[model samples]
Target chain A: MKELSRRGLLGLGGALGAAALLSACGEASGSASSDSLSTPAKLRVWFMKDSVSDKAQAWLKQEFENKFQGSTLTIEQQEWDGIVPKLQTALASPESTPDIIELGNTQAPTFCAVGALADLSGMKEELGGANLTKSLVELGSFENKMYAAPFYAGSRIVFYRKDMFQKLGLAIPKTIDELTAVATKIQTGNPEKNAHFSGMFLPGISSQSAFAWVFSNGGRLAVQKDGKWEGGLSSPESQKAIAQLQQLWTTGSTTGTITDSTIGSQPYTAFNTGEAGMFFGFNFHLKKIKKELLDAGKVGYFNFPSPKGDAVGNPFAGGSNVAISNNSKARGLAKEALKLIFSKPFQEFFATEGGWVPGNLNYAAALGQDELSKVTIEAVRNSVGTPAAKNWALVESAKVVDDFFVAMGALKDPVGLAKTADAKMTEILNSK
Target chain B: MTVTSTRAKPEGTLPDRTEPAAPRKRRRNPLPYILLLPAVLIVLVDMGYPLLRQITMAFQHFSLEQQFGKPAEFVGLDNFTRVLGDSAFWLTLGRSLAFCLVCAALTMAIGIGGALLLTKLSRPVSVFVQAAMLLAWAMPVLSSLQVFQWIFDSRSGVVDWTLAGLGMQGMAGYNWFSNPLTFFAVAAILVIWMSVPLVVFMVYASVTQIDESMLEASTLDGANGWKQFREITVPTIAPVLLLVTILEIIWDLRVFTQIFILQKNGGITEQTNVLGTYVYQVGLSGGDYGVASATALIMLLITLLLTWRYVTQFLKQGEV
Candidate 1:
């Protein structure tokens, strides 16, 4: 009983202190995070790991110091997976704000929409002006103003096993049917190597890659019907694309029981392991394939064939976008950092070292590094962005997304399944 | 006799001493609670505050915009109504319930069997068994999850190779995560494997505390080993078993890291998702805090309902 009393007093005291601290931290009117200084001398710039490769770090450091003479630019490299939550937490506190950050190109709209990104309309010309890719910029725009600058563009290419294709007596496919035929033949011919081989590694989880399919068939994800966003999944072109993709999953691709990409399997991993005859992945996969295989000669690359004969490869262009934080203490230094990033010298490193096509259109010459570079560059040039809609993120994160793809993988009737999914997608998209 | 007792009071006896001698000088000092104050402070600051904050946030129409200085509008039960109406919330809750119950039952069964086996073994053998269980228990969830993914990997997992060696044609490197059953099986197996050690330890400790005289008495009365265990040993460890069961249920219900990591590894996020992972995906990834928090509170309510009996039993035992 004496022990109980002591424990009770201690618990009460701790609970009181905790409640007080919580209210102090959570209350909007609290001054716990306020700063008296008008300007912060040191600007903290948080970027994802591998965004700036080792080769460009030296040049970037010198440029930042030279550009912003008295101040310092502290670059904190964060991993891709943890950056979102960390950014959210930092954005919630004025004291922990970083001056600049890099967001995934697809995720930029959500951040911009949520008021986490600074308005970059003032520093437009200094960053890139007319030289930036229009589609990439559109992804970062909200309410008729740009919030982010296109940092890099990663385009997909069809990486194939050269020897396997040669053994099957096939040339690089030019049309969607030809590619499907090649994958089928290769998968069927060599049962030993091809039993586990997905003739093509098109993951059900990869909606971006899947979107490219629908778009290449001339279907938009959303159409401006009556001045409001309406989903296009039920359209004839989309149905046609879904039907073809469903057919691929039924006969040409691996069983749903074999591979799932959202579970973390990379298209490149299968291709490198020789378990896939063909794969569609970023051109950045070339380095990984080279490192894994130890010899780059064994692999070959080609453009994703269109349904139209010999038309340009049109992939879903994906990359990171650079943005100044809305809560940033030093916007001037961040702009200076952006100036260096946009320069010819810095942009060239993206291709030669970083394996990304620079967002600047003039840096197209960087594609001379490898044979696959040209195919990927062409795809990026002709690529389409996800529809500029407010509810795109909501639709992407909806439960129906998985069910829709799983149904496709299960070989459901494409038209019926797509129509059902379209209704759900529209519901989520229409949510405020 | 009264006269003789009064004669002894003339010595060094100071009156009748009716004050109870200050509780006979208690052995344990009251200051130990003071020593524990720091740990209590840390837990309240780190864990207790966040939980209370989460509960409060559940009622507000909060968003990323309100994370900084913007005030959250109090919406009463609207968030709960919205979440309870969501089709996905119900689906995920159903999945979580099924997964947790199955995992908890399996773990308890396996743990009890393993504990009984340990008792029958020699000291060295039992120690080695305990050590093995401890090793698995000590392994980090993420690292073991990675191993599990590789073990079930379609292209190169050993499960497929063994299946092929058995003359199964298309069973090699099976993507175990795509199917709901296979995904749950894999998740359950990992959870059970990780949790069995704690249950085993608790059962073993309680079993050892059973009086040897009771076992001997049951045996001498012509009862067999199994009969003695059922009548005497089981009753002796009943409370421990109940405690372990309650804990296992709670742990299984709240499982997040393993499923989340596996989803990240296997790309079957939608199909393989449980309540904890679903909450994170919706709340953090989808930025739908209202729905996530409401779902979480519902999970808490479900847990409370399920464990109410055990809690009452424990409280009754405490009073006794």
Candidate 2:
């Protein structure tokens, strides 16, 4: 037994030595030809999942290679949540930095303010400068200087279980109050046959999204007062909106608060299981839901009702923005790539293949006649981006976003809670 | 009483204790220490450095906003005081202890019982039982947890289906995680299932060392089965049992991935967070490293205090 133990120890020592030697050799080889590698004029591009989906990505990669010829463009796929930290780390070191990047339109103000992005003031004329969405272009600007070009943008639309609603004898709601009454009735009716079936899935974790309802009701999240920003959540208009949402929860929500930011498994599962009747999601959600409900003829899309009973306003626009990174070694090449991205061909590809409303509104009419495409195009036009702020990224990092939603979800008096949230937001905004 | 005659003439320091052995011309052989240097270096670099850095970070107002910069100040003991006073901290600590204790106790009971049963069985049967334990131990925790999550899924889980099949109307398809009792029950069952294999293996390994004659003598003396086990088996495996219990307690306290994944699936993060996941949420997600470090140090202190007695007892048993 002792001999076997000693042999085992010797064998372990040999294995460790071998591993160390192999690693050392690998490191040595990598460093040896480092200087011979053509000065590394490579363009690094980071994009989100569907910002450039498979077809667009393949076409763009091939096109960029053919155009740039001498320079290499490396594309990276990053999830929306991890982009902030990844950018922070990448920006800290010039070597690790990307050349061209995609930013959420809401996130652009902060990045531009911090000077983490390259100012696009010079590239204005080349990037369809005059034709971009005015609000979106303004969002990417700090001190009236553009830092990013408008990329993809889309708005939230109401998707419903059509068959379930029909079975419940519920007509489509045209106003906020009417929507609430219908949701309450459907929740009580439990038309889907599952006791757990809910009329809406307003997850507590998605406070920012839920705030869109308040905004669509002519309630702002914050307002600037004498050079000081004050939160608008405590306003009577916002409270009324929140109260309407809370009434739905009180009548019947899912067993717990569901956050739009997090769907532990898959968000579409709620619809797939016939548990949820309606969800306020972006245009891209149409692609994820359409196939699942197509066979049953169960799913249908509509715009969220406006408080004025006329039409939806400021419907929570979310999408990606294309920008040239300040830290890139291949800035020239990356600028060339951005040109290709904004071109009519690429923008049309975004609409036709990727199911996103291209940043260029002109391409909306070109998306072929399909139900999903038509609805997506309509959602894009009515969408509103988040309020632009210099410290918006910091606010997200402070993790108050989750807390604000959670408090709203659990509050007995949502009006009072919104007041508290406003106070918290002011503190956060003023801290900068 | 007689004064011994010192052969040397000098009174107080006679003969210099056999000439002091001449200081032995010491040869500084550093080979053994050099042989141990890698292990010591590994520990210092891998474990000690990170722990020291964590301690330093606990004293600062470190945040993601200034993640790359120097901390704002060295607010001595302020982070500790703030964390200690937080109500959420106390609640989380209570939950962690309850979870650990329950898991540890259950694992010990099942493990020791299985070991005892194996001892009474034939050789082949015992081997088969041990093989089953090996398979359980080999199964990945995440894989098993994923299976359990599906089985308990509120909508289409098999458990709810079976209940409904039996004509249990209201009870069928219940979301096990919605209620606190069922959440802890499912969590405890998963933890205990994953932990028992190790406890069983350790006890079984130690049990083989016990003499058969002791059990035989106890049986001949007309002791009952329970009495024989109490008199013979329990004492023999007491040290192994203690060791396994201490390990199980530590493992259960730090359980993160299972609960994190389960909460993600089950919609129970607020209700079901333990120390590991809570620290991760605060430090990484919340971007408050100072608070996380304080919380982590508190967890370390707690585990140390809880296991101090068992560790000392195990050491004493080793000496015996």
The per-model DockQ list reads 0.23, 0.11
Per-residue lDDT over A333-417 for candidate 1, one digit per residue giving the tens place of the 0 to 100 score: 6677777888998898988888788878788687685567777778887787766666566555554555566656656667776
Chain B TM-score for each model? 0.87, 0.87
- Chain A only: TM-score per candidate: 0.84, 0.86
Candidate 1's DockQ is 0.23
Off by over 4 Å in 1: A1-44, A65-86, A95-98, A161-169, A191-198, A255-265, A273-275, A290-300, A369-371, A397-403, B1-44
| Poorest 10 consecutive residues by lDDT, candidate 2 chain A | A24-33
What is the C-alpha lDDT profile of model 2 across B181-228, one tens digit per residue?
687788899989888888888888888888988878888889998897
**Candidate 2 to truth, TM:** 0.78
Q: After superposition, how far is residue A377 of candidate 1 from its true place, in Å?
A: 2.7
RMSD of each: 6.1, 8.8
Model 1 chain A: ten consecutive residues of lowest lDDT:
A27-36
Classify candidate 1 by CAPRI docking class: acceptable
- Give the per-residue lDDT digits (tens) of candidate 2, residues A282-378: 6566667757586778888877778877875557777777787665556656777888888888888877777677777677566678776676666
**Measured by TM-score, how close is model 1 to the native structure?**
0.86
